[model samples]
Target chain A: MASPMSITALASDTIINAGAVDYLILAVYFVFVLGIGVMASRGVSDSVDFFLSGRSLPAWVTGLAFISANLGAVEIMGMSANGAEYGLPSVHYFWIGAIPAMLFLGVVMMPFYYGSKVRSVPEFMKRRFGTGAHLVNAISFAVAQLLIAGINLYLLGSIVHALLGWPLWVALIVAAAIVLSYITLGGLKAAIYNEVLQFFVIVAALTPLTIIGLRKVGGWGGLTDKITSAAVKNGTSAGDQLNSWPGNDISGFSSDLLSVVGIVFGLGFVLSFGYWTTNFVEVQRAMASDSIASGRKTPVIGAFPKMFIPFITIVPGMIAAVSVSEIIEVKAGGSVPGGSSGKGVAYNDALLYLMRDVLPNGLLGLAIAGLLAAFMAGMAANISAFNTVVSYDLVQEYLVKDRDDSFYLLVGRIATVAATVIAIFTASLAGNFSNIMDYLQTLFGFFNAPLFATFILGMFWKRMTATAGWVGLVAGTGSAILVWALTSFGNPWTLPGQGSAFLAASVAFVVDILLSIVVSLMTAPKTSAELNGLVYSETPREDLVDANEASHPWYQRTIPLAGIALVIVVILNILF
Target chain B: MSVNTTQKQHTAGILDIRNVIGALLGIYGVILTLMGLFGDTETDKTDGINANLWAGLIMLAVGIFFVAWVRVKPVVVPEDLDTGGDDPAYMEKH
Candidate 1:
């Protein structure tokens, strides 16, 4: 009989003896990436070049970077862990949660953003609501990016320390230095180029692991068979693991932690739309495209690759759920069990387990390099977005309005360094989090959930006033925080944190919408001239470049690409 | 101070930065893949899966394809593009 594969033994042994060949490959990869950063820096002369790639990026590059910005080590590792822990239901994040919002961003929102030529998302807020709203958004956005980047850094450092047996501080500092090396020199251009490169690296690394892991479990059908058998032998049913809406129930341990209702509204509509549409970290890539039409196509082009990412990301988790036991140790909680793989696979370590046990030495090095690249690029994306908002929306707008391009360029570089350092510091404080994915989503709820409401009213509704915009934002953010604190710390709650996060966001979004409407009616609405290009109805007809978009060739248009992605998503959902 | 801030340097379309990096990575990827596939079978870190060979081969192909794609359709710079201090976009930011 074949020896039983224990996750702990394999992982411990593999980390200890990763070999010199792998080390060499990693060194070479680092040197090569640094070289690219140096070369990309040659184009930098002004703030625009540093912050937005001089607005010269093509659709394909920006599109790839757009998605890659989100494909950091945390996302890859966290999603994979969720996949193993939750099974096929985990794919709800990609299919139902992500694709629709991406499509909406491309088809509906891009025209206004690109046509108006706002320097940042907060600038759009400023144009629509006034400086108060701008200050609120810019400060919150900058802080959000800092927190997210720090979490990514923390995760990357932990993974490195675990895999290489290096000190976490050493890993963090080295990674931080590498990130600053490129971004500080080339700014957004380097970040974008690296993100595009990292995108390929991620695909090259993870796709093979998914295929190999599947083969080990006897393909998709076999994998399902194994999971069901494993569950049955353990005296439980694979009800929720196999079905997306398992048990027709959303709460409790019925396949997924959240109910179908929660998944649909909280994750799919509210969270997905909030992140994909309004989050500057992802949208900045699309806004950097060379032309208005090209900018519009960025998210659409990204959506095609995005729809299929779950295969490489989540499938491994499903494989690990059945194949690897004792992947992680969970602490005691109301919803969580107090043991390692006692209830299920240790989700965070799913991809790492696969890396240690499945990939051979030479390929293992490349895979690890891919993981590292993803982490770095993810950080770069956040830093790039952070620095831009700091330089343009906050510093230049508020502090030094009459500064020249070179002066602001210097400020941008200094801000990049400052923000990255702060992120590194914040990353050190992220150790106590239970799940990276949950932590990230909760953070998103705190801001994006309410920001989405503000953006929606400001963009589509002509009657939304500046007073309404700022007041709604403040009120909405306050409500989100209040709900979070009440549920988590102040009082005992029935719902899980994720559920509370979703519900809190829903409340904030609703409150913001009602507040905006009520306040706008009470206050004076901006006249047509003041509202031009800011509000949808009041936007000048010529500014709507997409009005004649139908006349463009089908291949050159955004609608067809979006239509294709929607069809594929529907077909996949039905078939699966 | 003597140089024009608005002017962008003209580079060959086939030699776009993406293509260059892709080509370099592809070359290295192919080397690692070949070593993994045909070299000594001793000391495989990944239990039984030849992850290096597959990942490297895929990387090589993708790198070459990106390079080829750029060669086929070179990027043309819009000389009169208004993307500077005097451009309408920046002028309205204030």
Candidate 2:
């Protein structure tokens, strides 16, 4: 992947003046991206090898890739946007909402998933619950991946459009082609390897911006002073803007008690847990690990970097909120006269405006490439996971049963192309929702919350019946929809901002769990022998973990690493 | 043509992840460092700090570390990676 890059380019809309050095830096990054794909393709010998990197990637690589897959438009632009608007509470997305669930995935959920050896999350559903749940999960997951991929594609295209002065459609196609080539050539290994590289590049791109931004704001103390002063100027409490606790703006709740509850249970328990533990995009990265220990440690290993990401992402947005003219004006309740994405100079414009105002040529180019890398990584993760589910879980399982391994591999490549094309159409849908984070949170609530409930209950309680699985999923999803409509449309609304998304997810989780327990009692369960690897009680302890884990050092071991990560996150929470 | 059709391909674990990371960063570092030396240093935007120079040097150091890391600890490549499925026990025992 280290081949010297001569990245293809079109005329820059000339939004930013990119010197020769800038082009060269971007060129080098793309060359590496494609070179990794070429190198990875050599390793693919069958469908399994293509989809899971032959399940042979080391922990460090998988770990970086795990976080990188998620270090997408959501983490960078979305969180930055949130930071500009919400301030200190935005850190909650990392410390409170994300880390603990990631640790749970590494410690508890991963062993179950790794030991079972299912190709996709939906496949696991089929084996445990039956075709009804399987189909629901597979279809919903596939749809979600496509829609999210579209969001990434939309973000990626925006960059290409700015760079080339191309029409939006052309930029979207060009961006899709760039992503498609690597994935179609190399499959999951390329995606994962590029993700790791993207992780580093993303860090490289953002670190400079964060440092300069912090320096410009006269460091941390100065930043807080400015943010607090601005809060007072806006006629709001500084605590709402500067403190992490209660986080009135983040939850969009007026009552401090309700806000805390909403954040703790809604975000921490339901939404974060739902997405991190059950989403196939993230899970697929861990599943590509070389060993059970490595697989279990993947998310935990990623947590270290994940917890620190807000510094570069949200912190920059905080800097921009006080610094950038556009952001400042938007904060003052004014609009960008010729604003691109909807209502006006949106909160989402915070990062891009900061990048424009502060970064010089060479650094600016590198930063742009970094944003592009994150977008590609996100879209690549979605496409890779989408192809696997379509090929292995749906097509091979039902329509084209008993297909040869080579046949499925071909089907996978085709599915990659299909997902990319579909994503191009869906990219437009992303623009209308440039309050994209809200919709994304809504999606996670609908798809992942109920699914997490089913997975959690079924994994721990072997008595949970297959009938309960399908019924709970359907009911949980419906309840989340119902809540979303009532709150957004009219009378007696309780939550605002992301609070409604969290409320919907919490309701979904409760609905799924309660219905699962009740329906399970009324229905029949698969016998213990049949439930073997699929359920907790039916499976032995040895099956859940690596027997040789004791031989490794404490750092290399899963629990100790996870324990260390948990401690660090707790400290970060208290400190921040 | 798909790579899967050919069987004797054995480059899986041999191409270490470090090598790829090192080479890319090294290229980026060298280019940025060169620009910092020869190109116009945009001090106005960065409040007088040489961002390209400083960032480049740090990236160069880290890239070298990764390259050295591979030499110190190489990845082991299995002759066959056909070991990636459900433990045969799941189906046979059932």
Candidate 3:
């Protein structure tokens, strides 16, 4: 008879041999990361250095760190899980949603933000809109950050606990403490350096695991044959049915034609334009670069490598799907496993299951480390970002009217520790939710999608008023909540799928914009000088070669490349 | 001072064009690659035959366009840093 703790220990040992060796390695890595944070703190003589690394991070560091910041535990686990469940279609999220947004940020929005020389995104909002709108956006964003931080922490805790037989709360506290120590000491600079390290570790771990897994299944040829056979056994054809295009019958989860179109045109545009353009977390990285050129070019440079992530994350899952048939047939008399049952294997758990069953000894530790790196990288960035927002936007803006550099730095560190604790608590509680990805998307949609639309309208449209900004924000969020509620009640509100919620939110934004326009037109126009000043305040004159000029070449190159890439992707998609 | 201002404006315009072109190309390339790799066929298979061919052609066209744009709008070298006489860090070494 297996005792409870012994069973847990046995399960963990089976996965990673989490004896003294694994613990020692993880401990050393944690110490090294904390040491870097302490080293980075030497330059923190003032608030500017503490908050933004004195805006002196190089292009490569910014680029690598920015990519790493986005590459968190949620993505690592989520993508692998999605790969197990959805096949190749999950790749679309990266290709369609993330890459374009990064490109847009590098070219179009970076100049405006970096040029304005604003320390925070909310500061820019206050300048563009007004006090009320700025406060609302800032508060909403801080809350969103808390949620993201919680999710990342929860995933990290679960993975660590599963692999090491540690208590879940102990794992959560350890992860949070490790992340908070660095973020509390060095702010964004420490986070970026840590992220770069994490990125390399993560890729190194995942790459070989993928190769060996493929080899175990008799290489790509054998894997393809197995997938085809399994598809037939599951009563689906080998072709379009397997592809996750719109109008497919593989349940709502499939990335069929309608969902694809919606994601590509609607969710893709909104996510890229909104999240990258206006979101403080993303922009904060850009703002901390050594120069405007570094700020803009880093994201562009980052996109080249980021394009390959799906290959790393999604391909392995597709490979796993081929073997799942055998596992399922033997265990449950069907082509799916009972462990996952109807609700589907918890997304990240699928990746863990693969690592435990397939890999040898040392390699398993590396993969686990990679996942930990992803979680740490994400947690550091989010905590750093949250601290910056709370300290700069909320605390300093509302409470402290005048403060010395030392005061602000001290406050920033305190805020970071507070934010990490909240995130850890939230992560422990969030495990009860069934589908983490859907939950994250729905929550993100309610706030971010509409926020993106309003920002675009505000920046480009000279007539957009503060009242309109407020109304649009409320209406978009309200409509998304309503739609989410209706769908939960089994309404089956399918224009294209669950993604319709995003579309509905966007429509609400448009309606708000029109109403804002009507209201603004009835009122007098603000002077041209005021409008021009807002637009061109940070914009450098044409003649001088400002730091912003250095990034121009990369941005210029990426635009046409993106277009050509899109055309090729579409053509290949159509033919092959 | 007046001459310096005129030079700065010209450089800014040239840089702006370069940034815009780079961004567009970057976005185009990523989207095309994704569509090629995971593009849905009429039959719902992973047949990326058409997507591969098209992506190649599109890349060639865009590559040519970027080359031409760079040739036509070369960046003008500036005489001094444009730091508005603020940060000494921006001042060029003599």
- Could you estimate the TM-score for every candidate? 0.88, 0.93, 0.77
Candidate 1: docking tier = acceptable
> What local lDDT does model 1 show for residue A551?
63
**Candidate 3 B-chain TM-score:** 0.39
Model 2 DockQ reads 0.25
**Candidate with the greatest TM-score versus the true structure:** 2
Stretch of 10 with least lDDT, candidate 1 chain A = A1-10
Q: Candidate 1: which stretches are off by over 4 Å?
A: A1-16, A246-258, A328-345, A432-441, A489-493, A546-552, B1-9, B13-15, B40-51, B78-94
Error of 3 at A271 (Å): 3.3
Instruction: For all candidates, state DockQ relative to the true structure.
Output: 0.25, 0.25, 0.03
Higher-scoring candidate on lDDT, 1 or 3:
1
Put down candidate 2 lDDT per residue, A381-428, tens digits, no spaces.
Answer: 999999999998889988999868989999999999999999998787
For A285-387, candidate 1 gives per-residue lDDT tens digits of: 9888776767889999998898898899888888877665444222111233322222333556677777766776666776788888888887888889999
Question: Of the candidates shown, which would achieve the greatest lDDT relative to the real structure?
Answer: 2
Better of 2 and 3 by DockQ: 2
